[model samples]
Target: MWERQDFVLLLDLDAFAPKDRVDAFHLALNDTSVPNDVVHESPEKGIRARFETWRVGSLDLFDVRSTGFEVRRTARHVRRHRERPVVSVSLQTMGVHRAENAGERYVLGPDDIAIFHELTPRLYGWSGEAASWAVTIDMEDLGVPVDTVTRASVRLRTSPVHDLVLAHLRTLRRDPGGLEKDPGAAALGTATTDLVRALLTSAAHDAEDRRVRAVMNDSLTQRIMAYTRCHLTDPELSPDRIAHAHAISRRRLYAVLGRAGIRLEQWVISERLEAACRLLTSPRHAGLPVSAVAARCGFTSPSHFTRRFRAAYGVTPREWRRHRIQESSRTPPDGPPDTIPPTA
Candidate 1:
């Protein structure tokens, strides 16, 4: 059913008979889609929706699931889409989604986000109620240059920013009221949309192939970044070890780090410094010595890390730790976590 006021198409297919189900809602979108394709047979029960809103940034949303058909939306695998002229940033809010873009396939699930040029041949399919949430945004409006958008969209590893956007989208879904009203809704919408491009450029991590190298490198960098966070105290951590474990070359490691806006050694040092700051700030780790904490986070020389830490954070590691402890003692829970609603 299409909601005129909201410009939203809501599809609920749980009630359709198995064969009837496939026949009814398997219709592909035609307005700006690549074509001459149809669903041969539908899978079992699933839900899907696609909608658009022409507000700031031309917000568009697509939600769908239909037994994971390779249903077409393009003329061919290589042909560019002349119709859907916008680049889309998609967030997997629930269940799962599999998309083929840039000649490589991505398996994404709830909370994971990806960006792709929609004008190119792209395919999205799902099964088992594989749900997703998305917002289609135009390229030119993204503030960053097309080259920057192109660079960032495929190179950067997913960041805290992506999680923040996912949180906002899911929160709005659970509470659509705040945005349906006046300036408040508009304000929130603007803020939410602004982050979309940031996430794209950041995820693109400055890669153009946008296929295996871009995403794989980004994912590797994230895992490496995370591992560094968890083991900041271990000085043994280095690019060689990371590359060996991930089965990539040292050049590839540095390239991945480059996408994160820092090279390998610099990145490791910086991440350790950040973790040290976090540890110092938390009351739990506040009692630990600055040097010990530094060592634990892979920082060798206390003075060197301290100088860099102060430069990066505008305060010494110890000072940041103290400030954090003080802040946490008074900081209340900001709000409920934006969580996925089971079996909507």
Candidate 2:
């Protein structure tokens, strides 16, 4: 009854398990953990557990990393621990347990799940020493609609669809095979994302009224912005340039960002100024003229930059630069608009 054929482990199974498949999935269940004993049993009856911590490039559209724990019933108690940048969703496939965390208690059973934001500083425990499976996903990794996080946490429900979704995700986790690059990976990634989103929405019914489409659009825009910033050193970088990079017309790009307030041009300049502010305080650029730092963000004229950066932050470029050099962290987050470089 090897539930996980990934690691080699002792599996005591009756005739029911697929002979060759059980042995393979059985071996896959061997796991290393923090003194937690995981076992492999019949594909359906015994405890079969697998887990691993995952980290990937965060700059991608799917900025997600995961830590997963899949286990059959066992007697050992799991100590509560906090995971930053993640929300822990515990699903009780076939066992029952009480989950304790952050002064809140929850009981989970078959066809049930619990949602606990591990991002909160807290502790947690599994009740009844019940064996279960849980997945720790950096909410960002799951490309969760940040705008809807408050709504989704209202409650947790179980969805059979998760069985299919989780299985596909696990397959992707192990397969390097996929689209050639971006467009390809992005397409499959999007599909994988839809299934997960559907399951999440189903569990947290509040999403029924949520703006799932708008959130996806906003997130896609963010992906475009991140891409633009990364390629800023390129002399051709501009609103049109970025739109082209994302395979959209310049007008369409602006339309996409109509919801965020301010035009695309303003957003890019704001981002550049923010980046420049941090560099303005750095030692490498401290001795250089303030104009040089402005140039780095695509400014050509010192006079124009000073007025904008100052307008944004209330201090002239040189004044802001000096303030930053002395105590950068104290520099107000809003760089004086007076110091912002003029529009290109």
Candidate 3:
């Protein structure tokens, strides 16, 4: 029914007669940004199909619950529709399913995740009350190498990060409100995208050369940055601890960070100092002591925080706060004109 609309769709084939199921399902699949041909072996009793889908930024979430059937995305369909290159991730929640693309077949059982290219010729088949939560991400916005993505689609074995991605996706599917709005939604989308990229890159590491490993290293760097950003307040946020948390050696972690021009120790200190600076400058935090801000930002010693803060910003924390407050007071009611800070 919503063939032309590009937003959200909730389709239930059970509401339609058997003769109309094909058309209804076709439109629903198209509405969810996947156009395919659905085939059934025989006319049977109670052919049920339901899809609940919504868009979260550039990503689309689809929850499908249906009976036994096969869906095909053929070369002809690809030519006629001219779909964009997208990465499709399926989190199988119930039963088993098979996906074939680029002459490779992958079987995904319960609690499994499979990756595929949306524009490629593919086939999907499942029996019984098969169901899954699927998400399609735009390839261009993925910020990872396209070749690795193509290789990863062939087959991806599950890992800790892969399982985390599945659990997070289940949360997203259950309550999408956290990803449908602004501000927080952007972070949510970015987190999900990074997790997916990390999962794919890690899975693609087998039989890879140095070039491909470099791409995978970039993904690892991103995941490490995300992990560090969230744990900056921890007193034990050292290279050893971070490396252990990610199951990578200290040497490998250093190599990965070096490739990105990031020194692990310096980066962590920089992040902590940045957080402390924000707190010092925030009006709401004006009453907070410098030592409190330092401790809150992971510095064990106030003296060390003061020395490092002065070295990085050319002023002590208290001096910087005083100067910022003076500058704010001198500005007119309209507020200081927008100025871009110089990048270090």
Best by TM-score: 3
Error of 3 at 168 (Å): 4.1
Q: How many residue pairs clash in each candidate?
A: 20, 36, 0
Q: Can you rank all candidates by TM-score, best first?
A: 3, 1, 2
Clashing pairs in 3: none
Better of 1 and 2 by TM-score: 1
Lowest summed lDDT across 10 adjacent residues in model 3 is found at: 335-344
Ten contiguous residues with the weakest lDDT in model 2: 58-67
The deviation in Å at residue 337 for candidate 2 is 23
49, model 1: CA deviation in Å?
7.5
lDDT of 3 at 314: 97
**Top lDDT model:** 3
Q: Which stretches of candidate 3 lie above 4 Å from their native place?
A: 1-7, 143-147, 158-161, 205-213, 220-242, 247-344
True lDDT of residue 248, candidate 1: 81
Error of 2 at 187 (Å): 24
Q: All candidates' TM-scores?
A: 0.46, 0.38, 0.60
Output the TM-score of candidate 3. Answer: 0.60
Candidate 1: misplaced stretches above 4 Å?
1-7, 10-28, 32-57, 71-84, 143-160, 205-344
Q: Write the per-residue lDDT of candidate 2 for residues 1-344, one digit (tens) a residue.
A: 00111222223223234455444333433222122232322334332222333222221111111122233322232333223344445444444554444345555665554454533322233422234344445566665554333334434335324455544443343322122122445445444444555556555453334554444343555546445656554545788777876578988888777864547667666766765675565554568677787788776677776777887889886777676445544446653222222111
What do the candidate models score in CA lDDT, each in turn?
0.54, 0.46, 0.72
For residues 1-344, write the lDDT of model 1, one tens digit per residue.
00112334444455555555544554434443434254433343343333333332245556544344554556463264554356666666656667665556677766566666644555666655444555666555545445555455444354434555555555445423223533445545555555565465556553353543543444455455544444456788777887776678888877777876767677667767645654565444547898888787777888988888988879887677566555555655662221112111
